[model samples]
Each structure stands twice: as C-alpha cells, then as structure tokens.
Target: MSELIIGVLGLQGAVSEHIKQIEATHCKGIIVKKPEQLHDIDGLILPGGESTTMRKLIDRYGFLEPLKQFSLQQKPIFGTCAGMVLVAKDLTDSDDVHLKLMDVRVKRNAFGRQKESFEATLQIKGFESPYTAVFIRAPYIETAGDQVAVLATYENKIVAAKQDHILVSAFHPELTSDTRFMKLFVDMVKKSKEIAAY
Candidate 1:
C-alpha cells in the first residue's frame, strides 16, 4: 500500500528530466549518489551522460558493486543512451565495463560522432504506437543474449531492449516530451512489487 519511490543515479547527466518524468507518473523520484539510498528505491534509472566519466564517478563514490547487486535483486532499472552502455555486459573494443548487468554487446557511439545525432520514430514492443527517440552519440546493441528481448530497432540496429527487470534504450527517451517509456518503467516497478507480495 505504500507509494513507489524511484531513484535516478545522480553521478551526472539529465537527472532533472527523469525526475520530472517520474513525478508525472505520480511516483517519487530521488537522486541517489550513495549506495545506502538504494534500499529505499523501488526502481532506478541511469540517465544519458558520458559513460566513461560516469563510470569513474561511480567507482569513486563506491556505487559500482551496489548497483550490480541492485540489478541482481531483480528491481526494475531503466538505462538511457550512455546509461545503456553502462549496463551492457559487453562493450566492443573496450575493456572497461561498468555494471555489466544486462546480457548485451554494445558499441559505443554506434551512430558515428556527435554530428551524426538524429531522431527517429521507434516501434517499441508493448507500445501501441511509435516513440520519438532522440539519439545523441548513442551506443546501440550489436548483439544480445538469449534472455534479452529486443524492444525497438532503428535502421535494423538494436536501439532498445529488455531483460528481466532491466530495460535499456540507445536513445534518450527523457529528451522527448512523451512519457510512455517512463510510464512503462513505473508500471514495471508496480508489477515487480505485486509479484514480490505474492
């Protein structure tokens, strides 16, 4: 009967936009920089930001192991853009892997450089219509594990995917005005709670 409280990893990036999206969903969104805060959140979001810098901060703040544990606990997690790269298990041509939670192989800046940033209407699974996806120096999934479900694709490239409690997008959903992806994350949180209750 308690209200849902979602946390956004506040190491860097568009944290406020995600908080606003969570607020619009009628759930609380808090910035979590410390590991202790994870205990209070029903779901967590890793927002779009510089992957390398965020990784360093996460290590400095001692959030790496805790976040890996959070993902292992089956709590809902939504990763956007660089966030997606952070969560991916495999990073092509790089030895640095952060959370390594989702079973996916990602290519950093898969869409070329910053000038190649573009937008597209993505036909995401479980959604009735397409979503306006904003790709900014995005990292797309080159390959995924058997457990990962492809959600949205752009030009035959994997742009979105889900595996168990983890959801990820190569594009920035928060950048767009639409809140469907945020809603889906909230709904995932509710469903996870319901399952836990049973």
Candidate 2:
C-alpha cells in the first residue's frame, strides 16, 4: 500500500463516492469526522451536499476553526460541489461561513436546485479527452485569481480549477467511473509529501 493518507471530511455530503475513488487509486482514504482527524492526513477531500447543512455540522461539531486553519496552511485539499463553495475565498452570491481557501468567488446553485443536476462531457485541462462530469446543484467559480488555473470547463463556464495544492471542482468527479481526477489528486498527494520533506 502507498504511504499517502487522504482525509475525506465526513461532516456531510457524498463521502462514500469520494472514498471509492480514493480507494481505487491504491491509497488510504479515511473518513475525517473530527478536528483531530485532520492532523494525520496528507491530503483532504470535502464532498458535495447541502451547503447549509454542511455549515451546521461544521459549527456543531466545533470544527469550524480547525478546518479553516487547515486549509489556510495550504494543505492539499479537493472540494466538490458544496465543498468547493466552502473552501473558496468568498461566495458573495450566497450567505454562508465558508472555509475560504481559494481566491475564487462561487455562485451557489448556479444550475438551480437538485433537479438542476446534470451530466456533461467536459474538456479537462490535463486530461486527454472529454470527461463525463456529474453536477448536482453545483456552484460556478465566478472570479478566479491569477494563480488559479482552469482545469475543466462546461458550456464556457469554469467547473474545475486548481491553485497550488488546493483544487475545486464544481462537478462531482467522484460520481463518475473515470478515475482521472482521483489520480491527479493522488499525484498531488505524492508531490505534497515530497515538498514537505524538504
């Protein structure tokens, strides 16, 4: 087994799906339900779900401050759907206590509600061909800073992006059978380990 350890924030959302992807990559995928759990992780994943409910859980579990600090440290993290919103610098389009990691502004429910969920073949940056993206009430990064690079786009909108070790996907890449995104994340974990050793 690989030494890379990934933490999937299990506060709420599609934790199982992300776990499946992480496991498929031959790395350890741990469900992080507590603030202490964040300490041992080499990388972290914030899954998709109701943003409001996720906030409540983060606050109720007293993880509000710790998670925020963790992201600020530039640890390798990938956020999907609502998770993307939380990790962003701010979501002026919506009202919520976001983790505020990336310098992107997210517009919540950009495609409507649950019924607005969709599937589209996206042209991801590093990927060779188009990827089947599953978006469930996803958000769109309205304003990305210069450091942020667009990883994937759908219908001329930025759906997937990365900034240093932090990645955010408006669509749920975990829901798809393709493991490219997860592989990229695993690669990121390895790179993070190498850099930390220096």
Candidate 3:
C-alpha cells in the first residue's frame, strides 16, 4: 500500500499533536490552512480545540464548503473533542452548528470545565482491551442515528461514534501514547482511497 497523507485542519486546536500521532502510524500528516491543501489529502482530522473559534476560523478561511464537499465525497474524517461538536447535526449546549456532517447530537462541555477533566480506560467496540481516553472539557454524543455505530462510552455517556467515513470522539485520543485510534483512521483512509480508485 502507498503512504497515506492525512490533513489536519490547522485553524485552531491540537493540530501538531494529531500530526505527531499520524506520523507515528507511518503516514504523512500535513497541516491544512487553505482550501487548496484539501485536494492532496486522503483523509482529514479536525482536532480538539474551542469549537466556536474553530468554526469561525473555518468560515473566515473559506473551509466550510470545501469540508462539506469532502464529506459528501465520503472520504474519511475523524473529529475529536470540539471537532466532534462541530460536525454534529445538533448541539445541546449552543445554537451554533457548523459542519452538520455527522448523524449525532452532541452536548458541548457535557463533562464540565477544564478543572473537571480527567482520564479513563474505555472499552471501545471491536477492541479486546480497553483504551485510555483523555477528556478535557469534552462533550458527549447525546444521540446517534441508526446508521451511526457507537464505539465507546464512559459512565453511560456516548463518547465515540462512527457513521460511514466519519468518526468522532468526545475525548482527545492524540493526547495519549496510544496509536490505535490513529491507526484506525489510517485504515479508514486506506480503505477510502481504495474505494475511490475503483
């Protein structure tokens, strides 16, 4: 297989952390600040950051439409923390909705403020062992559509979900040393590229 190139939206967030994780997976990770950069990526990662700021930057940088087009093409998109909130169809915490590409409804900061942040081991579906998840003022999915597959939950709150090529998590996986989530996304990129090639 060819080396996969994944783009991390660099508007605002844990951009470099995600790039580090992607590189740890032996894939090329590039920071995308312009719409033209999106053309070269096999997949995209919207990292954890302030959703409102990210949303504003995305709009100011003319990324909203391109991102929607990318999602429409069914390429893999992994949204972490606030990124998850950005992609959701509904948000219980605020009226501002950005991407609306995912089939889930998220509640922003459902876990509380920064001081309330903590880490836990999550039993993600399809994984035999539990994965350590880091939640930093995170948001959990309040609801998922029938086509959405729940991946992990903490204290009965939905933390991870996947719908077709879109994946979301309320926690910051890049903050950990675990490469499982990054690998999963790389695999999704590979599979998406394969399907597009055919």
Error at 131, model 2, angstroms = 0.5
Off by over 4 Å in 2: 95-97, 113-115
Name the runs in model 3 displaced over 4 angstroms: none
Our tally of clashes for model 1 stands at: 0
Q: Write the per-residue lDDT of candidate 3 for residues 1-198, one digit (tens) a residue.
A: 677999999999999999999999999999999999999999999999999999889989999999999999899999999899989999886778889998888998897675358998999998879899999999999989999999999989999999999999999989999999888888899999999999
Error of 3 at 10 (Å): 0.4
lDDT-sorted candidate list, best first: 3, 1, 2
lDDT, residue 25, model 1? 88
Off by over 4 Å in 1: none
Residue 20 local lDDT, model 3:
94
Q: Distance (Å) between predicted and true CA of 196, model 3?
A: 0.6
TM-score for candidate 2, please give it: 0.94
TM-score of each: 0.96, 0.94, 0.97
Full-model lDDT for every candidate: 0.91, 0.86, 0.92
Q: Is candidate 1 or candidate 3 better by lDDT?
A: 3
Tens-digit per-residue lDDT, 27-107, candidate 2? 889999989988899899989998888988988999889887776666789988988988888786766647777889888
